[model samples]
Target: MSTEIELPPGDQSLLLVDDDKAFLTRLERAMQKRGFSVRSADTVADGLAAVEADPPAYAVVDLRLEDGNGLDIVSALHSRRPDARAVVLTGYGNIATAVTAVKLGAVDYLSKPADADDVINALLATGEAPPAPPDNPMSADRVRWEHIQRVYELCERNVSETARRLNMHRRTLQRILAKRAPR
Candidate 1:
């Protein structure tokens, strides 16, 4: 005697768009385990095409795509498939972007390094759907401060080495650091 076995797929499918290969692979596995059949595209164009053809129940899109920006994808998705839910993932992590993504059609947005579980939770929290970090995490002032601190700690503060390494100006950097040093 012989037996035949088959498994039924879940009703909810997901589209994941990101340029990071490792992130996409890992997310694919995780989402699959969570009963979501995930389709991945490294570029926004491909994602748009997939969505057009298949129209998944949900989409996890990156803010930055290889071929084009993810914002464009979000806009298109919102305009084309109003029924589908979407979430935007980004590294820039700014409030403006998050708001824009939502206004465009994403249900919510989250920053990079967000875990699969967290992402799943966020999607669930959205009940459908998809900013930036506060003020450039690496602002010019922060850069100047760090550059000076590092240079001083090394006891050299050599303009050439510090500036060259940081791709900044030896003189300009020095001036910035000096401007903030309790003077």
Candidate 2:
């Protein structure tokens, strides 16, 4: 059981970019439900192409994609439409990347598992005040899981390489990576 946020209707266009197909689809539907004219891409290149063709009024981009980092999308969006309000989402959040996201023109940085309401608020809020901090932040175990997944992705999903990079036994890394992310 979930309650939906009611956002006022608008003609503004929005772009959603994430490598995870299910997450991207869910975000697209949620954004559309909230009255945004939403467009989605699952790769950085496609997202950049969309931005080049027509910059959106708002954007929600993942920090990492299969082909490249989502920051590239933000940069392209910036060049095409400097006023576009972009938010960067990541499962592996860190201060350095958050700062880089903002520097690249993202208005907000959100960790993964952000709900539709959070994303909408970030996209549409006027610059008066910041949104409230997340009530339930990721736990330490969740953070560790996210980090392992990120390392695996960065290694092109190569188990041995990721294990070597993470300095863990290959079997241990495999077992850890195989489990679903913790809540």
Candidate 3:
């Protein structure tokens, strides 16, 4: 059986699953800015608890958490709150996990250093389902890359803050974004 929700008119309540406290706080504030009510957790267990206790209308999950794979968290969300939408964000973007995320019922997948807006867009974009790509390539690559860059710039290239929000590391983010930067 499915639970009914009063569709959020402007912004919806959201569940944020990640292991970084500072980043989680920043994200929660950003979501609140967009009129969202955010309930946060630093591990899969905490996420499951929040969902079981007071389910949110949506979830913004990182593919990797300090304790375990965020996929497990997504699965729990689906099983407990089937109506809730999910968007998986990752720092180690790869094809296998990306496919698995969709298979597990995520609405979209994203790379790290992601902006709150792109995350929100993936959460709230309610029309024209994206084509089933054999592999979700870098089609959203340029736009996503650009968005992340601006965020990095805004954070003054502070790798810790950027990585925390993007769920990545100082080195990894530097390396990846370097590849995307213009020559």
Candidate 4:
């Protein structure tokens, strides 16, 4: 079955900013197949340059990049083209960052590994109604695990710092970190 989404008549230019070369290439190809004039950048600097040169009508930006955060690109795009539709994609998804993305004019905030169809739908959605719930929402255990993992990463993977920040016992945090992520 075709996953292509028909975009409304307008400028179909799309800017995709991601650090993962493989993911960027795959998403670029997929978006092109779906009829977008796709432009991709693997770093925040390149992404900002693309936005300055010519802001696209749509954007799918990774929240984290090698040089800087992708939110910078999103901010620049919105400033250049207020009407542009932007979606922030991140592996470390959190409510605070999602709110910030929306405040900075992103149309949506999606977790990493989002498919082309999901990105397209988020870009084209009219915002007249709330988005439908995920078909397979993360379980509570998974959510907790993800949060802990995010915290651990933000703490520079220092178990002591992460545990202290989380108000969790060091041994407990270590145990959780050692276990595989919950589905």
Give model 4 RMSD, 1 decimal: 3.0
Prediction 3 global C-alpha lDDT: 0.77
- Most TM-score-accurate candidate: 2
TM-score for each prediction?
A: 0.64, 0.79, 0.65, 0.78
What lDDT would candidate 1 get against the real structure?
0.73
- After superposing candidate 2, which stretches have Cα over 4 Å from the reference? 1-10, 156-159, 170-181
* lDDT tens digits, residue span 1-183, model 2: 234556555547999999889988988897777678999999998999999898998999999787989999998998899989999999878899999999999999988878887887787777899776656667899978878887888789999999999899999997887788888
For all predictions, the C-alpha RMSD in Å is 11.3, 2.8, 9.4, 3.0
> 16-111, model 1: which lDDT tens digit per residue?
999889989999998887778788899988988987887777789999776778988777777777876788997666899998998998887976
Q: What would the per-residue lDDT of candidate 4 be over residues 115-147, giving only the tens digit for each residue? A: 787888899999898766656667889978988
User: TM-score for model 2?
Assistant: 0.79
Better of 2 and 4 by TM-score: 2
Supply candidate 4's per-residue lDDT for 101: 97
- Give lDDT per model, in order: 0.73, 0.86, 0.77, 0.91
| Model 3 error, position 41 (Å) | 0.7
How many angstroms is residue 135 displaced in model 4 relative to the true structure, after the best TM-score fit? 1.2
Model 2 clashing residue pairs (backbone): none
Model 4 TM-score is: 0.78
